[model samples]
Target: MPRIIVAEIDSAEQRAVAVDVWRAANAARRRTATEARIRRIQEKLDTAELALLAHYGPRPAGMLVAETYHVDGVPLPGYGHLSMVFVDPAVWGSHVGTEMIRDLQSRGWEGLSVWTRTDNRRAQRLYERTGFTDTSNRSTLRDGEEIMQLAWSLSET
Candidate 1:
C-alpha cells in the first residue's frame, strides 16, 4: 500500500497540488466546478486559517481546510470548524479523508465540527466512522439544499 502523507500546504507547489486535488474532488459537492465555484474554492483556500494536503503515495489526493470555530464573530476556545475535506475522485475509497480527519484529531482539539449536505451519505458515513456525530443542527444552503452539522465527541478524542 502507498503511504499517506499529511502536511501543511506551505508552498506554491503544495498549494497548487491542493488546488488540483480540490478540482478533482469537487464531486463531493455533487457537482462539477463551475467557473464561479472554482473561484470560490480558490478564495476559501486563500482565506482559510489552516490548509493541509494529504498525499496517497506521490499524488496529492486530499485537502483539508479549517478556520476558527466561531459563532456570531466570537471565537470558540479549543474548537475548529472544518470548512472542507476533499479527496480526489481517483482516491475516493482510499481512506484519504479518514487520514485528514485523524490529522485534525491528533491536534488535541476540544472539539471539531463540520457540515455536510444532508443527502451526502458517503460523507456522513466517513464522518461517523471517524467519530463525528450529528448534532441535529441544520441549515439551508444558498441553493436550498439542507446541511447538518456534525461534532466530534470528546470521549472519542
Candidate 2:
C-alpha cells in the first residue's frame, strides 16, 4: 500500500467517491437501497462539522464525517462525534482509517468519539489502536435495533 493521505472532500465528485466507499464497505450487510443511502449520507454531509476523505495512493479509500459530540442531545464541549466512517473493503487492514484518525487528532480538540456496529470487531480494534476506549454507551440505528458501540479518544492536539 502507498501512503495514506487525508484531505477535505471538495466537490460533488469527491462526495460520490465517499458514497462508493460506503457502499463497497457495507456490501456484505443486508442493505440494498443505494439511492436512499446516498441521499442520507449527503444530508449528513450537508450538516457535518467536518467531512474527510482518505486516499491510498491515488484512490479514495475512506470517508469520515463528524459533528459536535452530543450526549442526550446536549453538545459536549471540545469534542467531536463521528457520525459516519467507512473504508473501501479493498483496503481492509491497510491503515486508511488510522490515517483518518490521525487527521482528526491533528485538529485541535479535547477528545473525539465515534459509534461503531457492535459486531465490527475490525473497526473496534482500529479505534483501540488509535487510542479510543469503549464508553459503554450503546444505541440502535435509525432503522433498527442492531447494536451500536461508542468509543472515545482524547486527542494530543
Candidate 3:
C-alpha cells in the first residue's frame, strides 16, 4: 500500500525535493523557471506558506505548496491557494494527486483553487472529481500559455 505524508517542508533537503517535484509537474507544459525564481518562490513558502509532501513509502512522490491570502478586499479564512502541485511521472496513476487534495481539504482548507492549462484534460478531470468547478477566470503565464482557473468552496453546504 502507498502512504501519504504531509510534512511542513523546512530543511534544505525537503526544499530540494520540492524543486524536483516542481520540475516534474511542469515538464512539457511550461518553461522551467530559473534557479533564482525557484529560490524566490521557495522563500515565499518558507515565510508564510504550508508545504505538503505525499510520500510513497520513504520517497517523496508528490508535493503541494499552499498559502492563504486575501482576494478582492475579502478576507477569506483558511483559503488555501495551491501555487504548485507535482506528482512524479513514475507515480502518476498511484492517486497521489487526489490524496493530496482530499487530505488538505480534510485538514481544514475551507476554499481551494488551482489553475491548469486548457490542454491538460487529465488534470482537469482530477480537479473536477475533487469538487472544483470551472470558472470564467483565465490567466496567462510568463511563457504565453493560457491557463484556466478552477475553484472549490466548502461554504456551499
Residue-level error in angstroms, candidate 1, position 33: 1.3
Best by TM-score: 1
Q: After superposition, which runs of candidate 1 have C-alpha atoms over 4 Å from their true positions?
A: 27-30
Better of 2 and 3 by TM-score: 2
TM-score per candidate, in order?
Answer: 0.92, 0.87, 0.84
Ranking by lDDT: 1, 2, 3
How much lDDT does candidate 2 score? 0.82
Cα deviation of 74, candidate 3, in Å = 5.4
Per-residue CA lDDT of model 3 for 8-54, tens digit only, reads: 67787887787777777667456667888788767755664678778
* Model 1 poorest 10 in a row by lDDT: 24-33
Candidate 1 global CA lDDT score: 0.87
Model 3 weakest lDDT span, ten residues long:
23-32
Candidate 2: list runs displaced more than 4 Å: 142-148, 155-157
Cα lDDT tens digits, model 1, 81-128, are 999888998888899999998888888678899999999898999999
Give the per-residue Cα lDDT of candidate 2 at 96.
95
Evaluate residue 117 in candidate 3 and report its C-alpha lDDT on the 0 to 100 scale: 86
TM-score-better candidate, 1 vs 2: 1
